[model samples]
Target: MIRGCIKTITCGKKLSRNTKHSNTSNTGNSNRHLPVYAKVAYILGLRVSPSHRRMGIGLKLVHRMEAWFRDNGAEYSYMATENDNLASVKLFTDKCGYTKFRTPSILVNPVFAHRLTLSPKVKIIHLTPSQAETIYRRRFATTEFFPRDIDAVLNNKLSIGTFLAVPDSATWQGTDHFLSDPPKSWAILSIWNSKELFTLQVRGASRVKRTLAKTTRVVDKALPFLRLPSFPDFFRPFGFHFMYGIGGEGPEAVKMVKSLCDFAHNVAKERDCGAVVTEVSGQEPLRFGIPHWKMLSCPEDLWCIKRLGEDYSDGSVGDWTKSPPRISIFVDPREV
Candidate 1:
């Protein structure tokens, strides 16, 4: 019977037929997904039917995948769960050595915030039909993603925000957000004091060749659970927000994170944002590494699935792989 099921459940790009059913005494069909980053860790998207929850099936599934990872040359293992998903988090952090990383607060990444940004440091400047033509030519200067999306954001009359780097005072690095470009969540473009972000930015510039087809399937299935459009624009500014810094950061990078977190909680009065987010892999390796972590829930373990090396700096530095670059905690872009 077990061998028969294996023959029935045909292997495809998204799923693979496994031999777990070889015993046939089991009750439900075994399920497995070869995720987009599987070559790196083979994210275990497993379920053994609803009736199989407590039957030790979940743990067994994890072990099966773990063995597969070791065979496939996975040096490190990683995973993720929502902040409230205590069960999943416990399984990884408490049981497995997988780490965690807190996504930024939902305020800055809201889709409706794309409605129109009116910040004093920046202004919600509208792009006209005339101006768009000129900017279109200049869009492809540094990055390749802007050219097409810029036109769309302008067409939607999307509000744009950017921090004009004050020359000399500090390196020109500011974050900007718009509704249409990137065609997913809000887009963030940051310039730092040094070349760290640039080095870190490209770590995941492309999808993992090994996991692309399967990744597209997961994105299709899990999309229904995401709720990013609920938050609105005109969000109060919070000085507390910080993202990962790749490459390398200031000699006082740790002190900077603590000070920023404190300002956001105590001074800015934003409860949602307790720490900064970082793309530590290439550009800002320590974006999540708050050396002297001072904020509540400031730094946590992140199960970075990519296997860069043991010196991964743990959850303190950016570890990039061929995975999707997701700005966790940001508003869903569906409503935008």
Candidate 2:
């Protein structure tokens, strides 16, 4: 058996610029951002065979992964896991010296729960990969694990497409119009179908929750026979749309988010998807108005970070140990 394995991808290094000069110069110390992203290695899919556990296999794998990251010029390494996974938590924090940091929530919405009407004042437009990348590079530049390869994500087989919702007052007729001058109160959404590529395994209380969800499925399946709209089978192992690349903050931010949610639900319904899912920092304002249920297995996911390489001892990176940490993470859709 392949006792354990870990996958890592290198993110960019020193991706900070002074807002005024747009340069990474130490000359202006006051203008330097505190959360300056240096080179980071994202570790994913660390696993050990149950039979091979407690033999230091997990620790050896982690040590090798960190070594690979350091050799590849990564100054920091990070990974995400569910809060309740005590084994993973211990391996990363106690054995690996990683610091526990961000807490982000994964939200799941049944596609057929309720129909939400979009405002007449807004128009939802489909976007090309290039168009979406242009907007995301500008908007999500500061977010963690934001893909440097937006075009790749947009072009992947799993990617359905990207969309934007903007005010009708902007008089936007097509996707190309935003290239010149994008609207102020606009929101971006990227939809990915995970049916063919992935599935979420229910565990613990979630197994019981899945049992309860069957009742809803029964009602949903009967709705059409009763002359009502019926929902797709959510208990099916796959068949979900993942929403990502979401960003917008205006006075109408909440409304824009709702419009996107409605639009996403429609997309999922058209494909007969089980449900739609997305994760955001718990503090993200977009969490409002979107329908979601608390999952026993996924109440909150943890993001852990650790420094590596010679710069690991840099004092400027700040002592994460000293303060109450608050992090806003943008989960990479490609990884999901």
Q: Which stretches of model 2 miss by more than 4 angstroms?
A: 1-37, 113-117, 173-184, 201-215, 221-234, 312-328
Instruction: At residue 45, give the lDDT of candidate 2.
Output: 72
lDDT of 1: 0.31
- Model 2 lDDT, residue 282, Cα: 77
- TM-score of every candidate relative to the true structure: 0.30, 0.78
Please provide, for model 1 over 88-200, each residue's C-alpha lDDT reduced to its tens digit, 9 standing for 90 to 100.
66765666556553333221221111122122222112234435333332222122112223333333322221121111223222221221111111112221111111111
In candidate 1 the C-alpha lDDT for residue 101 amounts to 37
| Candidate closest to the true structure, highest TM-score | 2
Checking candidate 2 for backbone clashes, the offending pairs are: none
- The superposed Cα distance between candidate 2 and the true structure at residue 190, in angstroms, equals 0.9
When superposed on Cα atoms, how far off is each prediction in RMSD? 21.5, 5.5
Poorest lDDT segment (10 consecutive residues) of candidate 2:
1-10
Alpha carbon lDDT at 107, candidate 2: 88
| Superposed model 1: Cα runs more than 4 Å off | 1-48, 94-109, 117-336
